[model samples]
Target: MNRQIERWRTWVWVLPAVVLLVVFVYYPIVDNIRLSFFSWSAFSTSPAFVGLDNYTTAATDPVFWHSLWNNVLYAVISLIFQVGLALVLAAVLEEVVHQRLRGILRTIYFIPATISITVAGILFSFVYNPQIGLLNRALGAVGLGSLAQDWLGNPQTAIFGVIGMSQWQSIGYTAVLFVVAIQRIPRELYEAAKVDGAGHVRTFLSVTIPLLREMTTLVVILTMSGAFLVFNEIMVMTAGGPSNSSQVLNTWLYHNAFLTDDMGYASAIGTVIFVITFSISAAQILITRRRRVQW
Candidate 1:
């Protein structure tokens, strides 16, 4: 009787969350699938079914392809700069930095992360302004006025500019994660490495990175997901700009569903995005497992 009562209590506690998931999460997912099979709710007087036409259209859309390629590029670039730089920063902070300075540095690094992505986008818009932007000012100061071309306005450099801001915003967050992982390493191992005359580089190669393999894998997976989901920055800064050069999957989906009132097509795009992100995350886990160094 007592165990039954306890189990009932546990279930009662879980009821709210379960109900919320069914309503907010599961329901929307089912509704999205249903909407995707028909024209948008806004467009149709009675939710007219269009079968596979939406999928067919999205599959052949050039904009969709461009957005996909752009997302891939963004993911790759963000991983390299964000996670790679974070690892380096973690290493430096762990070994060389003093305690107070480390805290200050972390705060400074994380400031960009605390701000809204949209705000960051707007701020960068000013910085990338062709006429009086800070970048052009800096270039002119260095007697490189010829090089001060339009950044966000130019299709060639706009995506790259977004990538830079995204990377900068992400680096500190990744660094903090790495710092947490690095701190978990046993001091005894580090001491043993020191006794063995293993210097900083050797200790890092042998002890630090190998110990944080799981964390590295986690960071890679999360960063890839976030990069693929990028919307606000592109939306605020370039709005898929100078000729759709900065368009990503999320932005493309938004334009389809909200702008074009094509819910079915957007659903197909969303589903595709979900599949790609899941596949990449799975691949990261598998690769990490294969490569994880055993201590």
Candidate 2:
């Protein structure tokens, strides 16, 4: 009797969450897919079933291709600077830094992560401004004015500038995660490596990296997803640009759906993005699992 009552009590708590998921998550997903296949507008009385028309149109758009290509480039560059640097820093901090400094430095690195992306975007925007921006002024002060130009507002450099800012805001969190992963590595292994007369580089390559495979996989997954979903910085820094050079999928979708009121077309783009994100995530899992060694 008591077990039956406990199960019922547990279900009572779970039921509300289940209901909410069906209402918000599942229902919206189904509806969005449906919207993707049909032509509808904000003012429409009825949706016209158009099969893959929306998808075809979106696929053919020059702007769509540009946004996707830019997003890919951004993800690749960020993966290098963001994930690569974070992993190295994490390894160094874990192996060398004293405990007290480790704690303080973790806090310092993670501070930007706690700040709102909007605020950081705005701050970077001002710093990159041409006429009176700090970056240009500093360059000019150091007699590098010839190298300085409009950073955020310029077509040639705006996307890279926004990507640079996003990377700066992101690396802190990546480093903290890496630091935690490296710390959890057993001390016994390092001691064993020392007995073998392994140098720092060899130990790291053989001991630290092999152990940190999972964390590295995690960093790749998180950063890849975040890179694909980039919107806020583009909105704040370039609004997709002096042209559309900085536009990403999310921003382009927003432009079509909300700004242009092409709801069906945007939904189509959303579906494509969803598919691409899923494929990448699946590939990451497969690659990571294949490389994983059972310890």
Candidate 3:
């Protein structure tokens, strides 16, 4: 009887979290899946059973494909600039022997990350403005005026311009995560590398990089997911404009749901995003786990 009471108390502690998850997470997901199978507008009183018509429509939509491709581009760029560059920056900071200098530099780098995304987006919009923006002015001052164009207005460069802003905002945040991981490594390993006459480059490549595998995997998953789910930057910067060139999946879904009033279609897009992110994250975890087991 005492054991039964103890078990009940333990469950009582866990019950609130379970209830919250069911209500907020699981319920929304299940509802989205149900909604994706119907035809409904936000104004509709009753949803009609559509039987995968929304999915079919999405498959045939050119703008959907474009948005999906832009998301892929975003992920690729983030993997390179956000994750890879942050790793390099973190390694450089870790090598700095002066603690004060390292701390100052780290703080400087991380400042952009603490700013609100909406604010950052608005700030970059002005920075990329054609006539009076800082970027074009600097380019013109440096005699590179020929290279300056409408960064956010040109269809070819719009997505990349938005991505550049995102990188500036997020790279420091990713670097901080790497810094924590680097600090956890045993100092004896660094000593051993030094005793072997390993130079700074060699030490970083051989010692630091090898020990950071788990952290790298984590950063990659986070950056990739964020890339795909990007909405605010696009919304504030270009509104996925200049002919829908910068439209991403999330923005496209927003357009469908709010502007077009196609909630069912929007739900279908959301479901697809869920599936893509989940599958990629699951595959990453499995692969990372297997590698860890092998090591």
List TM-score per model, in order: 0.92, 0.92, 0.97
Segments in model 3 whose C-alpha atoms lie over 4 Å from true places: none
Q: Evaluate all candidate structures by whole-model CA lDDT and list the values in order.
A: 0.87, 0.88, 0.94
> What lDDT score goes with residue 11 in model 3?
97
Q: Which runs in model 2 stand beyond 4 Å of their true positions?
A: 1-13, 293-295
Can you write out model 2's per-residue Cα lDDT over 214-276, one digit (the tens) per residue? 888888988888888889889987899878888999999999988898899999888877778
Superposed by TM-score, candidate 1 places the C-alpha of residue 114 at a distance from the truth, in angstroms, of 1.2
Instruction: Identify the candidate with maximal TM-score.
Output: 3
What digit string (tens of lDDT, one per residue) describes model 1 on residues 1-295? 9999999999999999999999997887777777777866465668778888888887789989989989999988988877887998998898779887988998888888998898888888888888978989999999999988889988888998998888878799899899888889999999999999999989989999888889988999998998888899898888998898889999999988898777778988887877788898999988876775432
Of 2 and 3, the candidate ahead on TM-score is 3
Residues 22-137, candidate 3: write the lDDT tens digits.
99999999899999999999889999999899999999999999999999999999999888899989998988557779989999999999999899999999999999999999
lDDT of 3 at 66: 100
Model 3 whole-model lDDT (C-alpha atoms):
0.94
Question: Model 2, poorest ten-residue lDDT window?
Answer: 286-295
